[model samples]
Target: MLRNFVILFPAFVSLFWALLFMMRWKRNSRSQNIWAVALLLLSNSMSIAALYWHDYEDYSLIYKLDVLETISTLSFIPVVFLYFERLTGVKKKGQIFRKILLFIPPVLMGGSTVLFYLIVGEERAAEFFKYIVEHDGALSPGFYEYRYVYMCINVYTYSAFLVVQAVLVFIYAGRNILMYRKQLDDFFSNLEGKSMDHHRATLKGLMLFLILVIAIAGSGNLLYVDFGFMVLVFLFLLGGVIFYLCYHVYFISYSADNFIMELKLSDEEALENGYGIMGEDDFGNADTGNMLRAKLLPQLTQVIEEDKVYLQNDLRLDDLARLLHTNRTYISRFIKEEFQCNFSEFINRKRIEYAQELFRESPEMTQEQIAEMSGFTHASSFSRVFKQCAGMTFREFQKGH
Candidate 1:
């Protein structure tokens, strides 16, 4: 265990730091929480491996470690599903089936353990450990046969799950990219100046890096036939590189300082005007209604003032964050806290509001004209949001107003 501890210490440390970083985001993000839990489980698996390395001579102990490994491996599936759900904005209908799938590996392994105990009994279990210790790293033929079957089952199940997850990830990523590209094309076609160029470059880089990372991870897994732990090490290193890119290149290069400064100014203005003030302490502090209002007002103002930007054909949180010179996490938090809406709803609300104003002021304009002028790519979306928000059909609004 000590020898393997030294070999595995770096991985454990990397995972710990990753978990810490994730915990910060997890407060406001379901996806981050899922990933954090998955990493923690993987860390547990590593610790179990260390224990097994020390007690490899004990067959019973080895079997118990194997059971732990199976459980840890299965835990990854739900995390993957949750990650995809967040990435694609898809909601699970019940999630009961998914939960069952996640539990299957552990249940099977536990059942096997019970069966082993029944066959060998408690005394034999102890005797078996002593016999293996005396035999010097050699196991009985029956044990080898059982272990081989177990390993095969694990490999097949894990590989099948990975394949399913990979397919889902690719599909989700593709849809997001397509939507993002369409929005960029629409916005860039209208806007000019360095800001637009900066946005374009940033989006391109972010999307490219995401695709590259996924490709690398998939390829690394496939090459496990030869690489084994080397591939896993490469993945760990790649994750570190991604963290560096996100912090230094993406966040810093975007100049989030401007956004933070703006937020500070807004806070001061709100306080001086007796509007509201929101404070987040380093320790656990309760959130107040005034503070919530204060934090949300600026974001709402931005949406109203920058309606054109928000009405992009393929708008997303990342694109909005770049435009605001902030991070996606901040944007997501603002939408949830202030508007009680998701990113899509926040953007749609802006579009609908713009359409409402057009319909009110430009009474002579047709529904199609108003929708187009209000930044809606289609009149259908305009009508849908208009009815939902205003509680009246577009024709009714036009007629009544």
Candidate 2:
């Protein structure tokens, strides 16, 4: 019973998270749904571990379940990549075809497992399973030849697949995450809940988890290590990491779907309201929009400077554009051209100046207090930006003041 519980713990944890993710399905986001499915498949995949840990007398039954086990294990790989793909907006055209291609490896693995079973036959398969369990894979040249060849092929192929999968997923996910940050900086002023920092942390955790998995698998296959207690420890750690990932995913404040939807609405409204965010290409003459920029620049400066719109902690380009009766692209371009920064940087620069003013007025103020007063939603952000803008740490700036 202890062995059974130990092997099943991660599966149970995954199922629990799948249900939790389902509870939020009313939010109707593709990423959430994909994550729930990934967890569900992960639960199914955990069942294979039980075959190793439990004292199963029915070798035939174990052979019969091998195909399902193989499918479950390999299927989670692509579903997980799909989840991150959607979360980070790396989705492209031909999505259905792409998904089908992603699923090919799992299908091939399951098919190969079935073919191997048919070739070995039920009697030999049971004997093979019995031998491995009874002897801990210590087979003589007589019995070992078949097992050794097959196990080597299986382990090496699976290990190679895992390595390639990890490389592709990490590269694409890391690149997309960096792009996500740039997107946030382009559109948002105060990026408290808008950042992908949580996702980046999760990616790091996944890297460690993958390393553990590779170590365990390679050690088990090649080194003939005792797996009973090791498997239990691994399951425990896997359960903990899954719990951390699920908890953070469930409570994540940022939603890419909502962000994109809001941006679409802003664009549609801008087009309908005669502030179409026209570019130089839209105008016949290169300098045609200079008069409009000349007229709007002062109003933009007045709102940011005199009216102190930058003090609003959740300020955005759309909000500023609405206040100035302009389009987002126009405001974005104006800030870039006139102030030599994006909207986010433009707002943060003013906020930092305000923070400096506060420090001079009240040198005893805390970082958190200054952050809140100067429109930064977090002190950590304030501290980082303070160093970037002031060329010194907050403490150094405060001491000088």
Candidate 3:
């Protein structure tokens, strides 16, 4: 009964998330597609193993499927990293090189199974299975005879690959996050890495998800515990991913547009710009920077007023630049020099100004309605920015009115 559950639990979780992924996949969401594929790999491998568990008569078939299992697992490690890479907007300059390094592990890990198939053959697979569950594990007396070969496939293969992959994933994810934090700093003097920003919040989720993946993947194969008990742990890992998938689905379905709206790019614009508008380092001045503030500042104000661009929740300098038909650095300087504030404050001030208008014009709008109409992504974000700009909470401001 317990054994049946170990298999059923993960298989069920996998199937559920697979449905969610498929739904999100229909929406053409790249993020969902990545995870959908990963879940499918985990599900298929475990399902195969479970179906054949009692059929030791076809033991070679099981071992071969385990080899396939290892490959399925190998498929997961890099794509998980790639998911973060794609999410965090890592620059593409060195990606080719990074991909090469990323793929080396799966390739190196594959060599283990090939060598296993060669020396041990299907006949020796049963013995290999015994070695895993008993003995000192790889230290069995016969292991020394063909020691170097056996150790290469067992000790030096996926075991080593996993360790290196964990270190690399941690360094890259952390580094990308720190750089993005710096970007938030440069863009808005008031904005902090407070996880209120959807990107930062999602980064936290990504870190959690990756940690769970590493912990489970590393330990699952080790089976250092009883194999039966280890299966439960793997089920727990699947549960963790399902939780992350729920989070991922929320963002993609509900907030992804809010986040993308911050870029103010159409899909075409994103492709054309290569999403390059926001990350420019030289916010100093472009050739067009020579325009007199007296002449250009009013145009900036006009665009914001006429277009009502201030109401976008995740609006960025790049969006403002695109609106003004100028470069982001120029817009960055415009907000600082003309408004004497960062982008967030400049935008929030306008939103508060607009919210104040709605208060009088409609005289019946809820704070939430006002917040939404004014371009806030959430009530909390709206209230926080409103309070910062108004010198009072929304209630206090309402009372004052």
Q: Which numbered prediction scores highest in TM-score against the true structure? A: 2
Q: For model 3, where is the 10-residue window of minimal lDDT?
A: 187-196
What TM value does model 2 have?
0.88
lDDT of 2: 0.75
The TM-scores of all predictions, comma-separated, are 0.41, 0.88, 0.68
Clashing pairs in 2: none
Model 1 TM-score, 2 decimals: 0.41
Tens digits of per-residue lDDT, candidate 3, 283-360, equal: 344543444455667878787888787766666676666666656655676677767876777777898899988998
Error of 1 at 330 (Å): 28
Q: What lDDT score goes with residue 187 in model 1?
A: 26
- In model 3, state the lDDT of residue 209: 57
Error of 3 at 376 (Å): 3.0
Q: In candidate 2, what residue range of length 10 has the lowest lDDT sum?
A: 217-226
Residue 107 in model 3: shift from native, Å?
A: 0.8
Candidate 1, which segments miss by more than 4 Å at Cα?
A: 1-6, 9-11, 18-26, 52-62, 92-139, 142-401
